[model samples]
Target: MRAVLQRVSEASVTINGKLHSEIQDGLLVLLGITHNDTDEDIEYLVGKITNMRIFSDEAGLMNKSVADVQGSILVVSQFTLHAATKKGNRPSFIAAARPDQAIPLYEKFLFRLESTGTVAVKAGVFGADMKVRLLNDGPVTIVLDSKDKF
Candidate 1:
């Protein structure tokens, strides 16, 4: 599993011109899943994201976690995050998990995130054509991969 977490002042997801979900003052997470990903990956990321000290404190230092600021989170499925572009201009999606294997993991990840109860959790429909919009707070973005954990 991999995730691109962007700190955002506000974010929303639209599908076919209809609003799906939205969040304010939180993280907009673009999540990708591979065939090998499991609950462990979800656990690792949930802990990291909720506790990540990217938000600023009153002293103007980046010392507060999203939980500390009572933020929200909007997670979207983005299989393209795993695109392999080494060989050609046409990227390969062999690393992305097929829907049959991915949907369950995606649901489980969302469930776990919500279970944390530290922040409001919202999500985009899996496998839907979603248009996401956000006001990136601090323009802060972080990429995390379970396979690369050291």
Candidate 2:
């Protein structure tokens, strides 16, 4: 599993012109899954993401976690995050997990995130055509890969 985490002032997901999910003062997470990913990956990321102190403190120090600021989170499924572009201009999504293997993990991720009980969580529909919009706060972005935990 991999996630692109963007700190945002506000974010929303619109599908077919209809609003799906939205959040304010939070993290917009684009999550990708690979075939070998397992529950351990979800656990690792949930722990890190929930406790990550990317937000600023009252002293202007980047010391506050999203939960500390009572923020929200919007998760979007983005299979392209795992695209393999080594060989040619056309990026190969062969590394991306198929829906059968990914959807359950995605749902479990969402569930675990919500179970943290600190920040409110919203999610884009799995396998949906989603248009995401966000006002990036501090333009703070972080990339996390489960494979790197080792």
User: lDDT (0-100) at residue 90 of candidate 2?
Assistant: 97
Residue ranges of candidate 2 with Cα displaced over 4 Å: none
Tens-digit lDDT track for model 2 on 96-125? Answer: 999999999999999999998999999999
Candidate 1 Cα errors over 4 Å, as ranges: none
Report the lDDT tens digits of candidate 1 across residue range 14-116. Answer: 9999999999999999999999999999999999999999999999889999999999999999999999999979999999999999999999999999999
Q: What is the lDDT of candidate 2?
A: 0.96
| TM-score, cand. 1 vs. native | 0.99
Error of 1 at 142 (Å): 0.5
With a 3 Å backbone cut-off (N, CA, C), the pairs that clash in candidate 2 are none
